[model samples]
Target: MKRLMLIGITVAALAGVAAAAPVSVEIATEPGLNVTAPQKWLQLFAEIGQTGVRIRGMRAGERPRLEELGGSRRVVGVLTRRGDLLLPGGKFRQRDRAALADYFDRVAKDGAEGVEAPRGRFDLTEKQFRTAYDALSEPLGFATKDQPPRAVVERVRDRLPIALEIDRAAERTLNNAGPLAEDLEPLTVGAALAVMLARDGLALTPEHPRGGEVRLRVAVAGDVADSWPVGYDPPASPRETAPVLFEFLSVEVEGFTLTEALDAITPRLGGLPVYWDHASIAEAGVDPASTQVRFERKRTYYKRLIDKLVFQARLKSRLRVDEAGTAFLWIGR
Candidate 1:
């Protein structure tokens, strides 16, 4: 009898504790809040189980000012870490109530998981900027055989999410440039565009308008003064960025032209495309095809090997990124 009595007492105690603490949402209203706001919130959370929510108004001299929680006109409520949701009451439509409830639920879930939510407009803006950059970094490729600069742009514009614009001057030049003979290796959309544009002495420039849309514009290389490069300098060491280029390889060239050496080396670059700055090369009067290259049969990494070859040919090599954020080697005077 004594054992049964003790078991009954323990069960009663657990029941009382469970009843005392239930899942809930607190809806605290500020002055000027619509009278029906509390009822609406209660109904919204009704199916979400017993929300032990209470509708109460703030006292006249309460501390939090409207400015502290965004503006009254712009904000509906401020979610607090102190387990209270303060709503600045105003007439709310069904859609508005739904939106507020959805946001409230998200905040509660985030809080439970110990995740900090984005605060204010600055964090949101930064997030958007990062997203845009990420999009450009996506790898892209298309057929380049017999495709002229204009045709390449048109084909790429269809695949790209952002807008691609060609000004009148650039269009005239691109249309005249004959179809590119060489099919460029796979590269980022930005890098591919850079190579195609370089063929016509045109360049790509990004335009930002008031509405936060990013558009790429094609302009005459001479007219822009500065254009986006084929790829950016590697952020990491050469070994990390182009590990294959750092691997030792044996090469013996008795008397091969620079052009021939490049043709042989291009296949070993692990798919990295190479762009020739024709304009600068012409200005410097350097002909890679005629310049004879001599290499002693030795084991060396391609990085050093190419450097010596370019130096002998009176040219320089730079790692750069195109509009699509693809890395490529740009060889120029």
Candidate 2:
């Protein structure tokens, strides 16, 4: 009897602990507009809850604040005045309010907590806004595996008016570039397109803006192809005939911005120095100081770490060697 009572007590205690655990909530909203009515916000909360996000009412004497909403396992959605929807808990932001809400709702129903808020304004042109959204959302839980890039392209093409004329040659080139397996999250048109652009080296341009038509342009790096050729093959991968060695007594980095990260690691890279593109870094909104990286791989190839740093900063890296045998790590777009 005593043993049974102890078992019951332990189960009750575990249940209590589970019940006391904080719930995660993610809020989704349409494009930012001045919300003057508290009821509207409340209604939005109710609607979000109806989608099964398990939103709890604010406690007595508790106030709604963005910073306070962020928790270790919590995700909060908010809209900036620039009409951008952001997930505040170090997650990527997206502009498709419905899809974001659906995603958050799914997460919440899985016993997570999410919060949503509206924040300040920022100036962003249409193109800039689209570019930023595409860049950020590509890494988020927005692209699914098993979805072909060509299918995504077709979907995007269908959304645009029939007036848009897709270059068949460019389309073929992009298709032949192979499957994009970047992120296995959920699939969004924008995210898929970003992957395609990154992988296939193809560009999309709004050619007849007034007429609502877009044009596909094939402008792969180092190539000026007026028309994509059949059975065209990309250049062979560059192999380093000789490897360089670097000696580092020790290296430790924490919360360094891109510049600081570079400064700290470049010295350990032997004579190879990284050339940073300020404009690209600024455009990507990468603050090196905000990023943390640690490396203890002694005598390792510098190119490996340089690639990692650039990837963490949401930029690209290329290695260039001059005729003088000096190696340069080019970082940026």
Candidate 3:
């Protein structure tokens, strides 16, 4: 009877201890983004109770202020050019050489006091070029009536952006005469394409099937187990069910803008024939087969940009605007 009473008292004490103990648990999360991701991507993680910026993509670089946004919110991206897809010697021009030549000429002739100084490259006509040069040389320009003989003349190609250095690099890669692959430096993406082409044993040709011009429009969507991450690691799964998808949107055997063709097929993403607007893919990405991409304007002097974009899985998203500051950036599984 005495032992039983002691046991009862001990049980009561144990129950009290259990009741006083606190219960706690930790919740795990999906993988996030990398350091170079825009602040917006990181902010998403912050919203979801994570710290720092993490990223998952085709590649990541340690470049700060991508296109000069600011620290901690730089843009990290991949650049790809249209190559074998083009007919031999066929290329779309982005920089205007003539404009570049004339603009820099004025910079060399006139000092920094000149207001009409050129910035980078521009598209120009001969008449425009001549008129611009005349403005800088005239008295109304920078030089005085007495003319400053000692005025310093500096060359832009050598002084700023160092065009000569750039040209030398380009020349080295041009290869002059070699296999198309040898001549094509292909940049960073070539590594992957080379592997893919080799596996198929297929040699890409610049010539079109019809021996003319053709354009390809491509749309991309990335998914992740958890995209909004903090700090320097990549999303857990950069691989996706469909990381890349392409549509012929249009075909111009002579001259074409791939974007123009993409516009036509923009409405075909939904079930091929049925048109839909609203879609989602959990919290991850859009269904390329049924979605369109849009952009947001972050910098507007030349083009708009997106600070951050989020997409949901299975979402039939559309292009709100080509280069707007935001798009459907899918995150989370």
Query: Which is the leading candidate under lDDT?
Result: 1
Best by TM-score: 1
TM-score for every candidate vs. truth? 0.57, 0.26, 0.13
- Prediction 2 TM-score vs. true: 0.26
* Model 3 per-residue lDDT tens digits across residues 66-133: 22222211222221222111111121122333442332232222212111324321222243334333
Question: Which residue segments of model 1 deviate by more than 4 Å?
Answer: 1-135, 320-327
Candidate 1: which pairs clash? Answer: 33-89, 190-323, 190-324, 230-321, 230-322, 231-320, 231-321, 232-320, 232-321
Residue-wise C-alpha lDDT for candidate 2, range 1-333, written one tens digit per residue: 957965764564344332222335554443334454223444554555533343332333433233333332454455444434345332333334466456444334322222232211122234433443343333223343455656656555545322223456655775675554434233333333433454455544322121111233334423432222111121333344124422224344456665677776666655554454444565677755576655544544455666666677678776543322334455666
Q: Scored by CA lDDT, what does every candidate get?
A: 0.62, 0.44, 0.23
| Model 2 lDDT-worst window of ten | 225-234
> What tens digits encode model 1's per-residue C-alpha lDDT throughout 2-87?
57965764564344331111223344466565566567557766644435555566555543212222211112233233334444
For the record, the alpha-carbon RMSD of candidate 3 to the native fold, in angstroms, is 34.7
- Sort by TM-score, best first: what order? 1, 2, 3
Number of backbone-clashing residue pairs for each candidate, in the order shown? 9, 17, 37
lDDT of 1: 0.62
- The lDDT-based order of candidates, best leading, equals 1, 2, 3
